[model samples]
Target: MRVVTFCDIDESVIDSKHTIENFQSGCSGEAQIAILDINSIFDFEENKHEACADKFTTIAIVEDDSDYDAFKNFGIDAWIKADDFSDINELINLIEKRLFS
Candidate 1:
């Protein structure tokens, strides 16, 4: 699986389609990015999550409600509230179990 991040993102998050496509592993792009092609003709949020379900996963961990609202608009698969966990280890354990189990 892959995780792609966009700094200073806009509400039109789907605009980063090319960046995601070129992120596939073993892709021969200029920067040797990963190209996990799900055979998508166009990059739309509707099938994007499903198309890359096996190849990519998006997640966010926010410390504030405002942050959560902002990140949620960015279309991530999962959101972990930092406040829900007491410490980094506990948070990490939950993440590991969620991802591996």
Candidate 2:
């Protein structure tokens, strides 16, 4: 399964570099992961093209409860708290379950 991480650049704990690197390192083999900044998506000029509509599984890293409604409304499969998970493996497991099950 392909995993994509959508994160807010303004968030203190999850910066652009960390978000990109974490997604890259987390999805190492056959499965692929891409990290995209939420600002890019919101900016039409920056994100000229839309993500593939058929690629359904997406995980958004949210900093607070307020962001949950918007992310969920966008059809994200899951919302993960960056500070909560002990490791990437736990996040991967959630992805696996959502995508495969």
Candidate 3:
């Protein structure tokens, strides 16, 4: 699956175990999943918003509990803490389950 992320994820955490693909912002393509790290960016462009809307699944990463409510208007499918997961594989597994199950 083609996975895109807006944050500067530590790819090394998952690169050895799984192949992670990332697409740049404003790219025209269908993505299986899109991860938005709100901790890094509070807001994005209209095009990026539209792109995430087209994604099958969209996960938002936030730093605080109040951040979830702040991003509620963005049509986010799910959310996770910015530093909750130690490995990208865990995040990937969570997304897989949420998307498939």
Distance from true location, Cα of 4 in model 2, Å? 4.2
Quick one: best TM-score, which candidate? 3
| Candidate 2: 10-residue stretch with minimal lDDT | 44-53
Ranking by lDDT: 3, 2, 1
- Residue 48, model 3: Cα distance from true site in angstroms: 4.2
lDDT per residue as tens, model 3, 1-101: 45566676766665454434455534434556666776534443343544443546776877888888877887777677767745556767777776656
What would the TM-scores of all predictions be? 0.32, 0.47, 0.65
Best candidate, lDDT: 3
The per-candidate count of clashes, in order, stands at: 6, 0, 0
Candidate 2 vs 3: which has more lDDT: 3
TM-score, candidate 3, is 0.65
TM-score of candidate 1 against the unseen true structure:
0.32
Assess each prediction's global lDDT (C-alpha) against the native. Answer: 0.37, 0.43, 0.62
Query: C-alpha displacement of 41 in model 1, angstroms?
Result: 25
RMSD of each: 11.1, 7.3, 3.5
